[model samples]
Target: MSVPVAPTPGSAPGAPPGAAAPGGGAPGAPPGARPPLLSRGRWDGVTTALRSPAVLALAPLTLIIAVFFLVPIFGMTTIAFAVQTDDGGTRIGLDNFLDLSSHSRAMRNSVLISVVGSLIAAVAGSITAFCIAQIKSERLDSVVAVFSSVLANDGGAPLAFSFIVTLGNTGIIFGLLGLEAIGFTLYSWQGLVAMYQYFLIPTMIMVTLPTFVGLRKEWTEANTSLGGSRLTFWRRVGIPIATPALLGGWILLFGSAFATYASAAVLIGSGGFPLIPLSIDSLLGSGLGAGGQSTAMALGVTMVVIAVVVLFFFNRLQRRSARWLQ
Candidate 1:
């Protein structure tokens, strides 16, 4: 017998030679060989394309922030430094800031009003929130909700006008009480604080309500089971948990009060209680060129600074409370 010819390992026996492998590649790839379908760079590109949905989704929000928030802030900051010339040219400097700071009475009044108003709102809000949460009556809760909704949206010139009618010299309350002859004036700082509280209380309640709702029923039950008094329970469990909401609400209230102008303008009747906003308005209306605009901007900047500082502390307090709650 002739020596058996060794069949080619990859070829069909007694059939055509040099037939391609089914996969069009060698049976076993080399240790470091890349797949023919997708190299590393191409794979990376595919992955990047797949991730583009996130980018697309974020684009609209990014555009909105850039256009509305960031642009306005940048423009205002720029104007704060610019000095306006007779020919409408601008020279950038710190003169505007100096002028704003020099208006000490306005700055002082603004600070005081904001602080007092915020504090009052915070206290009232916290109390209202606590009471609403603890109360079992649905009708009362509904009333509170409706009341808050009305007050929170009440702002600007219309709100000022409303307050003027409600709390002004000829206000319904004073008229009903027949106290006009007794010289009841809602145009004072005290009246402003009270008017601010009308809205502030509702805002505070809304802000703090969630915090109250978040309180564990078990905590209250356990406290009561342990014979802890209501006051003790509040001190030990309630305040700590709600501190963040309370502080945050207060900061928000302060910021709102700081920026308020229409209400102050309407109630105080101009020049009598020149808060920072009023001062800014006067400067802008004075036709004092870029200097006035810059000064007004600087005052705005100061208000922003105050708000930021309050917000920072409030945030810190919130974090601490969260940690304690956890």
Candidate 2:
């Protein structure tokens, strides 16, 4: 005779103790059966509800970028490729790029200026940051922090004017020092780099300060205990830890210097120096010649390419540094 199975626990009265409920006739079916796919107790529904609001909020940002940023970039790319007609229509071609090669000097000058200025700023800023972070006095640290904060926000036209007033011929500083008639001009490419550094140094210091704080003092002490000189410690330990942040800050500084227009424009005048951004402004406005516009766009493209390469190297450095730290 077959063994009788008891009804499953919690089943209706008179059902065998091990028998399944009305849903099925198997023993212990309730615990062993698959759970309901959309059970209210499951985490999937809760997670979906929690994430839905965030997804909804991001929709506006997505729409804004699509409409404003991507659309304009597409239009600029189109303009960079097409030849402009006298009647306002563009004859689509590669003439724009072809014209860029003719003004290679300006391109080279801008790249050289940005690279040199950024490297100088990075080195100066890193040293300043290292010094400030290593200091033991709270008051001095607060003062430096305030200075960095002020300079970081101080850019654009006002900064340009300030530099002009300080270094420009016939300005107060130059005039009082009798440098104006001595053939000193702070309105050249070198002058622009100097002005850029005023802001770049402070900005880089801010970027690098946090990295300095994150550095453990133990490394320096350990190196000293091992008879390593200060220079040796810095070369072997300090730089490796800080190199990623240093390089990243430099990349940002370079990008900032590359894109700056108003400062250079105010100091040097539009035609005197032809940095890419300055050139672009002139091309879009009074310098609306075909060659000017094409060359300006090409220079803009070049600046972006340089920025990309710098950022890529910086990120690789960061990853390597992080691994080393670990």
Candidate 3:
């Protein structure tokens, strides 16, 4: 059923590939034609990507992070390295990092407080989550979630002021109840940890609640049906499943407590307790103390590094926990 077909004028018989046709165009093309500058498919792909829902949704957040977080971090890192000169100038140097030796006590205090507070919050929060799981009321669960959310976000000046009113000198507990007889004070190291607990425990609860609540009742029931005791069920299944979340929550709490400055600033107010955050504040805020602004920035940079490390481990543990939870 073959029919005689006429060849295009430009595509003549025995024509060489890519040879110019009669009207100054490539073979098989019309006269005076040009190739496309960009591939239509590639352009369409780019257009589709621009119109993607995920990209559009993330645009604002990406801009905000770039402007606020990344930009400031870059500026801070630059300032951290830019050592002040005696001639009232700046030079790129490690003077600030070297000056960190003077603040060893602050470093030690920061590590101690963050570690102890996070550990305590982890244990206490786990217990609280378990207790909360025992409650079957949906309303109570919602209430706890809301309460934990609110308290987890609670800190800074208001929290400090509340603590001051409740525990500071001339306040209710110490002033009226005479609890000061036991040598209790809100401005001490122990009190700082207590203040950290005010929020960290709730943060832990927020992190652990889902895991605890979502624990499959059937697993425990099967264990019990298999002649296992309640304690044995928990000892084998509960602890193993919950441990990752607990560790991740602990690391998160550690970072939170480590970076905390507002509440501590208001409550301690340049007190004897030399925390890393407080030290940075003092060094930078006090007209550049012996360590100077660069030193404060260095401390800030150190915190950023520690936070990054903590977040890395936390994410890994969260992934591990997610597997078990799922």
lDDT of candidates 1 onward, in order: 0.72, 0.70, 0.80
lDDT for model 1, please: 0.72
| Better structure of 1 and 3 per lDDT | 3
lDDT of 2 at 122: 93
Off by over 4 Å in 3: 1-64, 82-95, 288-291
Where is model 3 poorest over a 10-residue stretch in terms of lDDT?
A: 1-10
Candidate 2 vs 3: which has more lDDT: 3
Candidate 1 per-residue C-alpha lDDT over 227-303 given as tens digits, one digit per residue, 9 for 90 to 100: 99989988998877787778888987887788787778777766687788888788778785546776777887777
Q: Please report the TM-score between candidate 2 and the true structure.
A: 0.71
> Where does model 1 exceed 4 Å of error?
1-68, 82-93, 137-150, 178-183, 288-290, 319-326
Q: Each model's RMSD to truth, in Å?
A: 15.0, 12.8, 11.8
Per-residue CA lDDT of model 2 for 160-235, tens digit only, reads: 7887788776578877888756666787767777888988899888777767765677888999999999999879
Cα miss at 24, model 1 (Å)?
Answer: 30
lDDT per residue, candidate 3, 1-106, as tens digits? 0111112323332333233233333334455665343634223333444455544665677677777888888888998898778999999998878889999999
Error of 3 at 243 (Å): 0.5
